[model samples]
Target: MKRSSRNYAEGESPRERIVNAARRLFGSKGFYATTTAELAEEASVSVGQIYRLFTDKDDVILAIVEENVRVRLAEMHSIFDAVERRELAMFEAIKAIAANSLHNEDGSLFYEILAEACRNPTVAERFEKQTAFYRDGIRRLAALARPDVPAAELEAYGDVMMACFIGLGHRTAMSPPVDPEATSHSTACLMMRALGLAELESGRVQTQP
Candidate 1:
C-alpha cells in the first residue's frame, strides 16, 4: 500500500492519523518498543508533526490511553443500558462484561501501555487512575446487576473482575495472537463459577432452549 504524503500542517487531519498510528504501534509492539519515528512512519507523516501536535511520545501515549478509557466507558454504558430493562441473569451480565472487555484491538493496545506503566511512575499513575475508573464502573454495574449482593461484596467482586482482566491482559501480551472470543468465553465461565452460580459453575456456557 502506498503511504500518504509527508505534507504536515495545522488544521489538517494529521493529529488523528498520528494518534491512530501511535495506537497501532503501541498495541502491536509496546510502549517502550514504539518510537516517534515509527509512529510518524505508520501515519505517513513526519516526526516533527507528532511533536507539533503533542509534547512528546509520552504525551501521545497518554492521549491514546485517555481515548481508550473513553471508548471503554462508552462500551460499559451500552452494556448497562442493554441489561437495565430486562430480567437478565447475573451470568449474562458477567458474559457481557467479559465479552466487551476481552474482544477488541483497543484492549490489546491498553495491555501494552499497562505493562510499561509497571516501571514508570507517570505511566503507572495514569494506568492506576484509569483502572480505578473502570473498577468504579464495575462496582456500579455489579450493584445494579445484583441488588441483593452487599455493597462490600460488590466492590470485592469488581476488584476480582479487574484483577482477572489484568491477568488476561498479561496472558494476551505474552501469547501469540490472542484469541479474543475464546478468552471471553473462558472468562465468562470462570466468573460465573467464582460467583457460585451452580449451573454456570460447571463451566458449561451453552444456552439451552
Candidate 2:
C-alpha cells in the first residue's frame, strides 16, 4: 500500500494508525485480498505491533466499522436535533443527506464493509448492530416528522427510507454517472411524500407555477 504525504499527528497511537490503514486498504483492495503484512507496512508499524493491539486483521476491520458507525450516528443525531429545533427543514435535510450519501468517500467504504459482512460472521454481527442503531435513529426522525403516525407505522417508514438510501448508494456507484442534484431533489421529494409531508410537496408545486 502506498502512503499518502499527509503526516499523522505525533501523538497518534499505533492502534489508530493500524485501523486507519485497514480502512483504506480494505476499502480499496478489499478485506480478503489485503494482507497483514500490507497493513503493517501501510501503518509504518511492525506486524508484532498489530497483533499486540488487535487479535487479527478482522479485529482491525471491526474497529474501523465501529468508528465509522459512531461518527455517522453522531451526524444523524445532529440532523435530528436540527430538524427538531426547526433549525433545518425536513426536505432540505433529506436533500443534504442524499447528496452526502452519494458523493462522500465514506459511502464507498460503507458498501465495501457491507460486502465483507456477508462472509465474515464477526463483521456481520457488528454491521447488523450498527444498522439497527441507524434504523432506530431514522425511526425517531420519522416520529418527529409525523407525530400523529403510530410507532409501528413509523418503524415501517424508517425501513423503507433506509432501503431507498441504500439503493441510491448502489445506483450512484454504477457506471452511468448520476446527477447528484437531481437525485437529491427527487429522493427528498419521495421521502417527504412517504412521511406524509404533503404540505412540502404542495409548496414545491406552488413555487413552480
Candidate 3:
C-alpha cells in the first residue's frame, strides 16, 4: 500500500504543519498568489522542509484536496450509516449537510481547487477523480435511502442532490452569512420534494440526536 505523505521525524510532524499552513494561505491568498516561501514562513519550517514533504506548490494543493476528500467521504459514510439504521431521516440528513457547508473552511478550499482545475490539467485530473469519489458515495447513499427508487432515477437524483449541495457551498462562501438553520430547513424541503418524498413533509422528519 502507498504510505501517507505525512511521515515525519520524532516530535511534531512537519507534514501536518505544512498542510495546515498551506490550507490557510491558499484559502486567503489563493493558490496562484500563495508562494512556497510564504508557506514556509507560515508553517515555521524551512523551505527545504516543505520541498521534502511535497514536490511543489501544486503537489501541496493536491495533498490538501486528498485530505479533504478523505474527510468528506468519512462524513458521507456516517450519514449513510445513520440513514440505513433509521436513526436519521433523509430530510434531516440534507439539513445537517447544508448547515455544515455554510461555515466550513472546506467549502472555500474546494472553490479554490476548482478554480485551479480550470487552468491546470494536473489539478483538473485530480479534481475529477476526487469528484467521482464524492458522487459515487452520494449514489450509494441515495440507493440506501430510497431502495424502492429505480437505479437510473436514483442516479439522476443523486447527481441533482450533489449539485444542490455544491451550489449551496459556493453561495455560502461568496455571499453574506445567512442563518444555517433556515437554509437547511428550506433546502431539505426542496430536496425531499425533488426526490419524490413529498409525502414525507419537512415537518414529519425528526432530527437525529
Candidate 4:
C-alpha cells in the first residue's frame, strides 16, 4: 500500500488524520458500531476536532465513502486499462478483477458503507453514484471484450457483471471467510456462459487458495 506524502508535522491536517483513522477503524469495527468518539481517539484528536473536519458523524462517513469510491474506481480502471491495452489475457484479467475486488484495502470499506447505506440516505447517494461508476466502467470493458454485441445489450451485460461483482463482495463480507479467488473464477465462468463464450472443456479454473 502506498503511504500518503502528508508529513506528520507540527500541525498536520485534521481532515487527513480523521480520514486515515476512519479507514483503519472502520475496516476493523465497521460503520454501525464505530463511534465518533472512537474515531476521534483513533485520529489522536478530540471529538470536536472531528466535527471541525466534518459536519457530523454522517459527514465523516460520507467522506470515507467518497474516498473509498475514489480508490476502488481507480483500481478497477487500472485493471480495465490492462484489458483495454491487451496486456492481460482474459483469464488473467478475470483473476485481476477478482483479486482487486476482494483483496484491495478500500474494497472492504466500500461494501461496509454500501451495506450501511441501505438505511442511511447520505450513504445511499454515494452508493448509488458508486454503482453508476462501476456500471459505466463495466459497460466500456464489455464493449471492448465483445464488439459484436449491441450497445444496449452490452449495457445490460455490464449490469450483470456489476451484479456478480456485488454478489462476490457480499459473499466476502459475510462471516466464515468466503474464498475470493474461487468466487471470482465461478463468476468469470458464469460471465462466459452469459456472453456465449467458449468455456473450458475440463470445467477447470485454477484456484489460488
The TM-score leader among the candidates is: 3
lDDT of 3: 0.78
Model 1 TM-score is 0.74
Which whole-number lDDT from 0 to 100 does residue 194 have in model 2?
72
Q: In model 4, what are the clashing residue pairs, if there are any?
A: none
lDDT over C-alpha atoms for residue 57 of model 2: 75
Clashing pairs in 1: none
Better of 1 and 2 by TM-score: 2
lDDT of 2: 0.75
Model 2 Cα shift for residue 64 (angstroms): 1.8
lDDT per residue, candidate 2, 57-170, as tens digits? 777877887886677678778887987777877787777767766765555566777777888898899888877887787677677766776778977887888887667766
What C-alpha RMSD separates each model from the true structure? 5.5, 3.9, 6.2, 6.6
- Model 4: CA > 4 A from native: 1-13, 24-32, 104-112, 199-209
Per-residue CA lDDT of candidate 1, range 1-209, in tens?
34655554666488778888887788778777887777878888787778888988777877887877787778776777766755455566666667665555666676666667876788788877876777777776766645667778878877887787656645544566656777776777777666645344543333322
Query: After aligning candidate 3 to the native by TM-score, how far in Å is the CA of 113 from where it should be?
Result: 1.5
Top-down lDDT ranking: 3, 2, 1, 4
Error of 1 at 70 (Å): 1.3
Steric clash pairs (candidate 3): none
lDDT of 4 by residue, 79-154 (tens): 7787667675555566667656666455567667767788888768866786677677777667765677777888
- Tens-place lDDT digits, model 3, residues 28-84: 888889978888877778888888888888888888888877887888789878877
Off by over 4 Å in 3: 1-12, 199-209
- Worst ten in a row by lDDT for model 2: 200-209
Query: What is the TM-score (0 to 1) of candidate 3?
Result: 0.85
TM-score of each: 0.74, 0.84, 0.85, 0.75
